[model samples]
Target: MNSVKKIAMLMCIGLPAFVHAGEAMVKWHDFNDYRDVRATNQAKGSYHKQIASSIEKHAIKLAEQLPKGYKLNLEITDVDLAGDVSYRGANEIRVVKPIHFPQLTLNYSLMNETGKEIGKGNDIKLKDMSFMDKIKMGRDESFYYEKRLLTEWFGEEILPKIN
Candidate 1:
């Protein structure tokens, strides 16, 4: 029937619009590291940048998983990354089993495209004690630890809570 064909065409165009109605986007990633410069590592700024990149990546994934028309605004401060090298004597430091925990104070919220607050104060210290998993570290293994924490947090906590 002519009416049935019109209904089918209308459904094809209308369904996707409804399905994507609550989707979100990564509006910004604002990282502020307030660690004392005296206790900072050589790669402090660069390392934090890498962490921000990981957050942006995962936030986008999270946005896709959530409903449509929302945006994520995240501000991370007081970043303390894992591991510390101990000074021995000369311009060198001991690298044996340098273990430390990474922590970041995160302040984040979600807003609709029309500027409605969907969530807030989700202010949390981003840290995962179980990320290491008793794995032996080679040289420069610190790079992956923070990312693992972010990924697991997004998957287990944020993803389910928002969607």
Candidate 2:
């Protein structure tokens, strides 16, 4: 009876480990620039650069958080920017813009180092506020807001697929 109990315990532990070992590993692919906004918008050089930088930073952070065996590939396909200027109280200036955060039509695929796609996250939405928002809110605030939004979105969309 004692031996039987020990065997059952071992099986319970070993089974999960074995299952985990077989799980797929994820390798993220570089984000392909489908449409370069810089080429299109020749006017707002500084603003464009800021937006681009934010998108890249957010993409890299999110990619790093994926599960051990799964990979996410991000690519920026289209970028649309809209600016809204608002007065902050009496003599203040504020710009609330529809930055159209670059719509990154990602080609997410789960695979080993070789190249076989075990799973695919074809279309994922990564949207960020305008550069002014980031500056006003600060990096930490922006990061937290973005992280929460992504977590909620991913949990709803991708998490279901994984489970």
Every model: Cα RMSD to truth = 7.2, 9.8
Q: Write the per-residue lDDT of candidate 2 for residues 128-156, one digit (tens) a residue.
A: 55433553343453224434444455556
lDDT tens readout by residue for model 1, 13-92 = 88766665444343334344254112234565675565556656755655565556666666665565555456666543
Q: What TM-scores do the predictions have?
A: 0.56, 0.41
lDDT of each: 0.57, 0.46
lDDT of 2 at 62: 50
Candidate 1 Cα RMSD after full superposition onto the native fold (Å): 7.2
In model 1, pairs of residues that clash are 21-68, 22-67, 22-68, 23-67, 23-68, 23-69
Predicted structure with the largest lDDT when compared to the true one: 1
Position 119, candidate 2: lDDT: 57
TM-score of candidate 1 against the unseen true structure: 0.56
Error of 2 at 63 (Å): 2.4
lDDT of candidate 1 at residue 28, scale 0 to 100: 30
